[model samples]
Target: MANSTALHSNITQVSVDSNKNIESLRMAYLILLVLCFCIFLYFLTIILSVYFTTAHIRENTRYVLFVYMLINDTLYLVLGFFLVVFNIYVINLPVPLCIVLVILSLTSFMATPYYLAVMSLERYVAICYPLRHAQLCTPQRSHAAIAIIWAVGFSPCVADFIALSSSVETKYFSLSGICGRPMLIKTPMQNNMRYITIIFSFTMVGLIIVYTYIRIMLIARKLSSNKSSAFKAGKTVILHAFQLLLCMSAFTSHFTETYLKDYFAFFPITNFLLLMCLPRFLSPFIYGIRDEVLRKYIIKWHSFAITLG
Candidate 1:
């Protein structure tokens, strides 16, 4: 009778512990949902603030890229949110639709780093070569450069889309399983291509950004006492570097998850959302908050709304 009573007591304790674990998981997800909603609201404010700001912002080439970054970031966040919701709701997505979703996701992922690289290069040229700036970085040329970046960014995704479409196995399209498992599994050749693309593309762009920033800093050092435009330009470049770090953190964390999962086995969904989804929102927020010019505009508009209310 004692043994039977002890077994019952152990079973009850196990059930209580299981319930506590389940409750903790639910609380974590609730916190993530609140964070996601807050980010969405912040994103909308940034978009609206930019839209209503003065013509100077609208006309500037750098700001043009900022706008593109926001749009791309929005697309990225929306796609991520939809995927999570779909996974939770267990809504079945069609095969072709899944392929399209994956392609779009890859395109956004590629465009972000390239955008930051271009922005860094722009600052570098503007700071290091003031004399040739007008001739070299004209509005028309800037637009063309942006177009080229987008095209190059999308190229790898297009290649994959074509390869996937041409595959004899129709099962590739049915990768809509919960936890998004099938998409993570790639052939050895695909893995090689991904590694090569990430290494080559990021290394080239990363080197360019680092070299350009170093040159800009050297120029700033020579005129350290001036407190002129060069100083402001250096500040802007530093902010860009922060944004780049955030962007790269997302990418690195994502790649780390697959390796981490082998050890942890039950990685939380919050990890992916925090690392991948959150960083995408940080770039525009840094731009809006750090730049004096942007800050003034946002503040002015914000005050006007308050007074009117």
Candidate 2:
């Protein structure tokens, strides 16, 4: 009787272990699948922006800035996806390749918010100072502004890479996860520098967005007596603010994933999707659908389809 009972116990234990292993395997692939789907959505957003946008709209500085943003987001999605797949499959990556990936990922992450802040400022100028907007926001200046955004966005990563420890023991795959290149915070100075960069960049941009919107609201209210145009301007202002909030969510999610590691149950997977891809997926929808000319085209297209049916 004792021998028979032990045999049954061993069989149950083996079954449980098998089930756990299967579940783990399913979860691993599920994350990779999700990342790929997000990348597809990013590509779709870019295509819609390019195809549906009117030539006149494309010529506008604001729209140009947006197109640049979409392009950056696409690059980030592709590069970040590779990193996720590599990390998941435990593919061995050389140190130089790892560093390059980290630089690109960080550049994308940092560049996006600056663009958002600039966008909000553009709206504020257009609504608050309509007469001088044409003079102030010329395409040449916009190009210069974009150049500055890239320069500032990439400066920190360059600084960090220069400061990276020469110690071979500190170099490990454990540092570079799917979400971001490892900070390699080996020294107290490096750790402090990271904190300063995050606080200055994100916090300053957040403040700029908030301040500009507040100013926009005050100006809109003062001009509310105009009724029709004020209503339209107010609506546009609100939409832009919504876009900023969406971008902010991505920023915060990334910080959480990187810093508050213990709190997330599945580690990088949930944080990666919410922080990294969610903005890329949602930004174009918010901007594209709200575009006046694009909306007209969409309505006409829908009417044509219905008539054909």
The window of 10 residues in a row where model 1 has the poorest summed lDDT is 178-187
Best by lDDT: 2
In order of listing, the candidates' clash counts read 0, 0
Tens-digit per-residue lDDT, 221-296, candidate 2:
7874654554565566566566556666665665676687665445565656666777776666666557776556
lDDT of every model, 2 decimals: 0.69, 0.69
- Score residue 260 of candidate 2 by CA lDDT: 71
Lowest lDDT sum, 10 consecutive residues, model 2, at 174-183
Off by over 4 Å in 1: 1-20, 23-27, 30-37, 88-91, 171-176, 179-181, 184-186, 224-227, 251-256, 259-268, 307-309
lDDT for 279 in candidate 1 is 68
